[model samples]
Structure formats: structure tokens, C-alpha cells
Target: MTVEHREAAAQRQEAGAGGPQAAPGRRRVALLFPGQGAQQPGMALGLYRADPRFAARVDEVLALWGAEGRAVRRDWLAPDAPDVPLDDLRRAQPLLFAVDWALGRTVLDWGVRPDALLGHSVGEVAAAALAGVLTLAEAAAVMADRVHHLASAPPGGMLAVAGAPEQVAGLLGEGVVVGAVNGPRQVVVAGAEAPLAAAEARLRAAGLNTRRARTLSAFHSPVVAPAAALGLPVLRSVALRPPRLALHSGYTGGLLDAATAVDPGFWAGQPAAPVLFGPALDGLLAEGRWLLVEAGPAQGLTMLAKRHRAVASGDSAAVALLPARPGDDGREAAAAAAVRDRLAAEALLPV
Candidate 1:
């Protein structure tokens, strides 16, 4: 059977243990990692201070980058630190990778293990590492090198358009590309500045709600081809292993074939490949009911996940690991507490 078929069969078997009368607690759990634009300064700060395990994992990831990484972490976690240019894709990618990976580790340490994993865009690197397909150091190196290569690309942008995929695709003229299919009505477009601006303007003029994604360059577009090529060697150098958990691919919008998951070229092309988040997520939900936990700085992916039919039908639940925004003094603490409470209530964690 194909990976998807196998996974579906496995999920059915797992769910069948309790038969039709099985309680909802028998459903599998999934951990999601967010891509770019979900990051924020001081993300998970409360957890870092209140939980040593979380703090240590964050520190461990920073250590991989040596002194520079340490400095970034210092600024990142500082309560009163000035706003760093996290808007720059080069800096944001690695920092976000570290935060996501650290947060995933923290969740696992807390005794909430996911049966399946999915990540969007750069988030996949963290998922790969956490699933044991790549080491933390390897993930960090790949992320850093990816940023370095992408930084050299020409300026570009991404826009989140609230419309059907076909509606969004109709607007992709010339340089523009459909970056991601977030949901049935949520599609992300990316490309050079001019095309992006034109498309955004047109979409808004048509009474469609749209927002500019905070990104330095148009990812998952042809503009990043050179960067993708340059980063291939970095990915190839990393030692890879089979994932310890089922890992869905954001690129293919489905479960990853074991070989493709470890292929260097696959990793390299991901940056320039359209993210089929909506489809991939659909497939994951097909496996079984899941508690979708967003292990990232914000709730962007969590919000998107909620738009899925399974989630909307109450077959699954989605929660963000960190506060959706920064600035509030105790937001992280409250969010963390809320997550724990929700998990316990859902029987995902010990009460």
C-alpha cells in the first residue's frame, strides 16, 4: 500500500480498538509547526522562565550556532530587549526553527507525544529534526544555510488572500505564484514586488479580504530557485534517518514517502515549492481525529488548521503552544496554562 493508504489503515486499526462505541479519547494526536510569519519576539518567554526543561531545550538549540546563536537567544528571550530585525527572512528562519524545535521538545517532555507530525514551510525542518530524521545541529545548519542563500535573492513578498484556490490562481499573472493553499477560502500568493502588489490590489478591489504576510522575500516562488539550488549541498551533507513518527509533507500535501523524507533534493526544493498545507492537513485528519497542537511562536497555523472540515466538524481540536501575540506581561503563562488544561480535558494529558 502507498504511505497514505498504510497510514489510513493504521489509523483505522487504532480507532477500532474501542469499536464504534469508542470514546473520543481514542483518537490520535498531531503536532504542527508553523512556518514564517508566525514568529514574534519574546515568544514562549513565560515558558522559558517557568519551565527549566523548555529553557534548556531552547538553550541547547542556540548552542548549535555557537556564540552568535547564544547572542540571538539572549536578545530573543530578554524581557526588555529591543526589537530585533526578525522581519529579515535570513534571521527569522533560524530563530523560528530553534523556537519551534525547542517548544516541540518541551511538549514531548511534558508527556504529550504526537502520533503524527506536520509542518508548514520552514517549520518542516524542525519537524524533521524532532521526528529523528535530522539532528538538531543538522536542522540548525540547514536552516542557517537556507537563510544565507535566500537572503541573496531579489526582494519579493507574500500575501494571504481570503478566497478559493481557483480564485487566487486566476490572479497569478507572470511572476506571481500560489505559495500555499491554507484552506478552502485561504490561499497565499507570492512573487516579485510588482506582481505581488498588483495581485493584492486586485484581490482587495474585488472585495476579497487580504493581508500582506511579513516576509522579506517571496518564498515558494521561482525567485528563490537559485537559493534552493545553493542550499541543496547543505541538505545533502546532513545525515538522515527514518522518522520515528509519521511525518506529513507540506510540499506534497500528503504523508511523506520514507525515501523522499530523507532525500537532500526534496529538502532543497521545498523552499521554492508551493506549500499544499490544506491538502496535507486533510490527509492527516483522514487518519483519525487529532488534537492539533501548534508548536510555534504564534497561532497562525493553529487558526488555519481550525478551518479544516474535520476541525470544523469537531473531529479534532487545535491549540497554539505560545501566545498569539507579544506584549502582554502574562500572556504566555496564561496560554500555556490554557493548553495544559485543554489537553487534560481532552484526555490528551493526565488530569
Candidate 2:
């Protein structure tokens, strides 16, 4: 690693009073950022209002989009926002990035140093930025371009199937394919609308439970090839560098390395690539005892982490900074504080 890279690693591993050496035998912290499926109405509005640092960081990220940023913040804060606005790629992509990036950022501002960063799907973009692989500006531009160009790809959707990836893969047709392998028994199929619908029917017929992810665009499949192809130039223009913190990538299903970090093609190809979050999580949890803190909306990633042997066996734990439901912002603020209090009790928070 270069000198700059080494410095970033130092910051993550030894920043603030919560650094590893600050408390002997404290579990190392790993922040988890959930991807697209976790988005919900009024998500994180509570924390955004309760925490000024989080709000500022979120505003800074959204500001990179100029006018579009203002509209997103406005819509995001509106109590009467559309019922399923989170499914719109244009809205979901940027807002999720802002929430994920800012939430993880403010935690660090409080001196809770993380040993590693992990994100699922678009959440990976936030993880990359926090890890020092890409700047917030670069991530915002890339995210904006993603929603823009992906509109060219024919309307597609994803179907989450339970009970083995092989079963789901076996049911796919020519236009549809396996999109993500989320866990031992959970996988997703992605394709253009008609084909994906047909595949979903087939999975249901086979006695597998299925649900569509809240996305208008089908990610992690060949249908996104056109968008990924179009976004190549924009991705390459960004000056991506090596990670400052340990980053486990869902794209590569392992620790993100210097070579892959700077590869524009690799970044562009993510849309057309299968998300192996299970494998990546396996690698991360195997490294050591960890306190996996979900910094994004919902407790989705935390629930997934709980299924792991490490967390199940009491070797590690997980916490979601935001709640699972979408009713009260006041309760949301209190919930986040309660989680942080638990972290403090565990010595994961700063001294």
C-alpha cells in the first residue's frame, strides 16, 4: 500500500478514543450498509433531524447533485411522500447513498472507530467512499450517472427466492438470470419484466417463497449490460484509490484490493454482476470477533448477519442504527440512541 493508503488504515484502526488499543479485548467494530431492498418510506428522517452532524454530512453528499439534491431532500422529508417512492431508481439511489454515507460518517465523528466497512449492492458505494477508495463527489456523480443511463435498459425487476440458489438459478429463462446470492437459502433472479415475472411464477410453483425487491431497474444481471457499458467512461474518470480501511466488497466477495479498487471496468460491471453478500460477510466475520453496526435504513443487514455462525454462536453481534418500521421519527431518534448506548456499554463507542 502507498503512504496515503497506510494513513487511511491508521485512521480507521486507530482513530479517536475507541481505537483498538483504547480498550483491551473490546470487539472490533465493522459498519454494515444495506443495499437497495432495505429502502422504505421516511427512513432515517428521525436520525437526520436528531443528529446535526448526520444531517450536514447528508446535505453535503446531496449537494453534489445540485438542484436534484434539493428535490431529493425535500421529497425525503415530506411526510406525504409517495407510497413507494423508494423504488424509483432516481430517488432511491441518491437518497440511500446520502443516508448510508452520512450515518456511517457521523458515527466516526463520535469517535467509534471501525475496523472494517461492508456494504451490500449500492451500499457498497457508500462503503467505498468511507474506506477512502473514492471521494463523496465521485460517488455521487457515479450514482447519478447510474440512475440516468440505466433508464435505457428495458424495464426489469428482481425476484427474491428462498430455499437455495440452485433452485432459483435452475428456474431462470434466457432473458432472466441469477442476480444475487444473499445467503445460504436466499437468492434473487433479475430480468426484464415479463421474463422475471415468469421466473417468479416458476419459483412459486416449486414451493419457494418469493418477493420482488423494491427496484424498477433489475441490477446484478445481464439486462443492466447496456447501462454498465454506457457508464464505463464516467466510472473510469473518477480517481479511485486504495482503501484506507478494511473493505469487504460484495462485488468481489472478499477484501477489496488495490488492483480491483482502481479498475473502472470492475466498478462499472457491478450492475451486471451477482452480489455475493453472503460470501463477503463470511470472509469478514471469519477474520475476528466483530460488532456489525448497520448504518443504513432498516435492520436488514443486521438480520442477515445474525444468520451467520459467528453471530449465532455469540462470538459477534449486530445492531441497526435505524428501525425496521416506518411510522414515527421521534421513536426512530430514540432507537438510534439506544443502540449507541449499547455500543458504548460494549466499549465500541469512544471512551
Candidate 3:
């Protein structure tokens, strides 16, 4: 889950140590926010407690959740045992939004504003908020709305298959569909519990390896259509505006244009459509040699960003703010220091 590429700017610039040269002009910064399975309980907890600027931003977002913010804070810090499991969107969605937004804000504080924003699945809401498509409060409400509606949908889950989307397309049954095209060879199939299990069996029989995404409900699949459809009315009420900064849509696998930004249907329909994250990253990197920063945990987005063609040629680079998991006690501080050192080596840290 880490970038082992020896060609990485961090490695190349290691000898420079604390001295950061002017960064490569071609690689403008782009902050990446991760979605559901990408997070673990207590992810970045030390960073949150130690960094006031980061903590302030996180608190600001969670405050928008009102009284429920207390529960979100408590559960996220104590991932192992909580009133609601992090796998449940009801708890996961709002918390992820807060963390993602705060992490992005922290990067912005370093004086290098990102040229673009990209997010996967629930991560999109955070990206949208950061891009000015929706205010943080509005985005929080929309996420809360999503949580409420999903309460009635059939319980479902997702299975990650080792094949291209087309390779898995033929095996899909009634509820099973491509939930996400994560990489060149990985696609996640999702549906109602029974149907998803059946789909997994089919893929396994076909000699394709499969694993479940960490969740109790299937997002970005047909199984969640009912919930998405039901939330459209509330979703439409949010006042949408064009992004002040660039944003690539995981749902559309392209940039977020002004027209699409204001379209409530585009936002409401996200859960029902497959997440085209790989294509969206392609669009972002294709725009320019950019510094892609994973503003969330576990280096998941960082790993994905590193796989792009842009990174291989030094046209772009990627970094993750937090280490693999959170609640590591003493290790969290050390991990953050290491990441900052890497950034410093790449001259990506603020001059």
C-alpha cells in the first residue's frame, strides 16, 4: 500500500534534507481524498490531536454536525468499539467528510493551494465542498440525508474482483454491477447481500480472486438506487455553485463543469453509478504534471496516484499525510514527521 518507486522525488531529493528548492513548475498540487474502505478507525488520530491547525479544521467541520458531532468524534477516535460501526455509512460518511476536508485544509495552510481536487465514492462530497460546489454545511446535510435514506434499502455489500470492468460485466446478475473501476485490473462488484455473494462465487469459479470492501452496505451500485432516489428531493435543495478550483468527478471520470456542478441529479445519482476513480485520476494527471497529495489516511489514494503515467516520468508525484492506520499512540507523531521529511525532500513542503 506504499509507493516503492525508487524514482520518487522524495528519494531523489533525499540528500537535500531540510533545504527545499523551488518545486517543479509542471507539478501543481492536487489533493486526493479517499473513500470508504480506504479508512481505518483512529486513522490520523495523533495528527489530529497534535496539529492545532488540522484539529481546528476538523472541529469546524464536525461542529456543523451539531450534537451528533460529539458521537462522530468519539466513535472515530475509538474505532475498535463504537456505538455504530465505521463500516456503516450512517457513522462513516459524516466522519470521513470531516477528516477529508480537514486534511485538505491543512495542505492549503502550507501556502501551496492545490490545482485540483479528486475523491473516490464518499470522498467526493469532501472534494466538492473543498472545490466550492457546495459549502461544508450543505455537504454535511447531504451526507446525513444519504445516511437516513439508506436505512431502508436492502442490506448489501461489495466484492473487489481481480479483472477489468468488462471482464466482470458478463458475470453480473440482477443486482450485481460494477461498483468501482479502481485500477487497470481491479473492479468492485456490489449488490444485495445474497446477490453479491453469488457474484463472488461466479468470479471465484471463473478463477478470478475477489475480496470484500470494508462495509455492511453496497455503495456505488444498483443496490443503493432506492436510497439515492429517495434523497433526490433533499439533495436538490442545496444551493450549488460552480467550483472556484478544478475538481474531477469520480462518477463522471472527468472535470466538474459549471453546468454539472449545479445539477442536483448529478450529486444525488452518485451512489447509483459506478465510481470511475481510475479514469478521474487520469483526467487530473492528464491536465498537467501535478503534485497529488492524499489528504486522508493509509496511503490508499497515494498508491493509486503513484500508478499514473505522470508519476513514472517525474511529471508528477504523490504523498500521503498520515501513516497506514491511526491510534498508533507514539508512532503517529513519528510517522507524520517522516512524511514531512519526505515532502521536504521533494521540495513539496512550503518554502
Candidate 4:
């Protein structure tokens, strides 16, 4: 069966399990990682300085993968590099993963263990590692290989629409498909150049504001089908063990386990399938008020979380997006203090 069918099957199984489960208490929080466009120069500086060991950990992984750590370091250090195109898939994927993983480690150090993890687009690789499904080294290698595979294809792109996904789906028609529902009114669509343009026109005609994505690959659409085919074997080759925590499936809006996630086909299908973010957000809110930590490069996911909160009632819990860029300027202290204060105020953690 195709990845879409398989993911649909998985979601049906999860729904069969029962109604949405509730959180036992305030300990549950979801870490949401941003995808490609989120990367900015000088991101992750706070975490790197707060714990130099975070960068060391990334270095150790890159060394094992025969990858150069300096490239990633440069992006985090001088984000506005005039020479380097920050959005290049090869450069963008791994660098983004490293920054997110570092931020995740920093959060872990603060005694904040996520009850669940959700990553958008390329961020999923780092999420897998953070969830303990893959080692840091394994995560980095798989992501690098995946990006390299993507680079072989000609440049493609995705666009954002602010409207209900069903509405967007109806407007986009044949070529473009729903890539993600970042929030109630925020969705991403992907396809070939003409189809995407057509979809954007329709969306605007339908009164939905639109923005183009920075990604070169038309992710979550059939345009990446060729790339997904090439990456399937690599994804299968990687070992995916059980996660230490619950992981929400991006291809399906359900709680995913390692056994199901280990199928290389599952990972491969994601590139050409719409991310089930809207339903996933529904599942997340059913549990409890989530802190909604954006552990990746930019605040893109955080922006989504804010909109989700605005639309979804019973989601009154505050959401905080920690700074991903590294450097010293009291951000680390401030973020940690915020976490502590939130936890204390909610009695989730000791003061």
C-alpha cells in the first residue's frame, strides 16, 4: 500500500484504541520543532553557551558521521553569512537538526522531559533523536543522507495559506496538496510551480492570505515522490528504536510507537504526504495544556502554537518558544527561569 494508505490505517488503529487519553497531570508538555524556513543565522547560541557540552555532543556525532561540524557552527555563529545560502537543503537540514537537538538537550538539562514530541518537515529527524528513537549520530547521518538525496533533484518549493485545510484542498485541486495545518487558519500547500501558483491564486480569490516558503523542495506533495523513493532505503537502513517518550506521528494524527515508526517506508512516505498537524494538534490539546516548546531554529512553530491556542478552547496553558540560537545575552538564564517559574506556578516541578 502507499504511505498515505498505510498512515491512514495506522491512524484508524490508534483511534480504535479509545477516545483521546488525558494527561495524568501537568508533567506533560509537547516539544514542537520548526522546519526549514525557521533557520536563521546565530540561532542556538544561547543553548551552546549555557552548555558548551551541547555543541560538543553535536561535534562527536558529526565526527562519527564524517561530517564537518564547522559548517553548522558557522551558521549558528554568523547567521547572516553573505556567501552561504542558508536555505540549501544539504546545509539547511543538518544545521537545523543540530540546533534543535542542542536546544532539546538544554531543556533536558533543566529537568524538563517532554511527554511528547512533534516536528515539522525536516525537524522530524531531530525529534526522532530527542525521543530516543535514534542516537544523535544516527539522526545526523540519516538527515544528511536524506538531504543529499533531495539535493539531487531540481529545486522545488512550498507555499503557505491561511485558511481551513479542506478549503485549501478544494482550492488547490489536482497538483497542490495540504502540506501542514500549523494552526486553524495556517496551512501549507505544495506542488509543481504552476500548480502552486494556481493554488495561491485560488486561495487569494477565496480571501485567504498566502506566503511562499523558503524550501527548495516541494515537500509533502507528489513532486517529491522521486526523492522519497530514493530516500526510502536510507531511512530503512537507519535503526529506529523505541522512543523514551510518546511521539506524535506527522504523517498521521496519532500517538506513534517505535515499532510502527521503524518501517523505513513510513519515514520515506512523509516527504510526499501532507503533515497531519491539525488533527495532531487536536490530539495534543485533548491531553492537557501543553507548554508547546519550539526547540528548533526559528519561532515559526511557536507562531503556529499561538494561533492554535487562540482558536482551540481549553488550551489556555501558556506556550513558550525558547531561543534556539546560541550566544550569551541572558537568554539562557531567562528561558530557564521562565521554565522554572511556569513549572512552579503550575506545581509541575519543585521551585
* Candidate 3: 10-residue stretch with minimal lDDT: 1-10
Give candidates' CA RMSD values in order.
3.4, 3.8, 6.8, 5.4
lDDT tens string, model 1, 1-351? 357657545764575421232265566668899998886767777777776787889888888888668767766766355445776785578778887898888777777767778999988989999888898888888877887788899999999998998987887688998999988898889999998888888888888999989897899999988878898888888787877677888998887767887888999998899999998888888767788889898799888888788888997878887877864476776777788788777766633
Query: Candidate 1: minimum summed lDDT over ten consecutive residues — where?
Result: 16-25
TM-score rank, highest first?
2, 1, 3, 4
Identify the leading candidate in terms of TM-score.
2
How accurate locally is residue 348 in candidate 1, as Cα lDDT from 0 to 100? 69
Please provide, for model 4 over 1-351, each residue's C-alpha lDDT reduced to its tens digit, 9 standing for 90 to 100: 345435643564475422233335444457777677786656656656665666675566556546355665565467666345777776677777776776667667666656678877777777888777888877776777677677776566789887877777888878778888776677888887877888788889988999998777788877877877787776677777866666777667766755677777877777777887767766666654566776765567766666665324544453444554444687855665676677667655423
Off by more than 4 A, model 2: 1-25, 82-84
Candidate 2 C-alpha error for residue 295, in Å: 1.0
RMSD value for candidate 1: 3.4
lDDT of 3 by residue, 263-294 (tens): 99988888778999998887667655676778
For model 4, where is the 10-residue window of minimal lDDT? Answer: 16-25
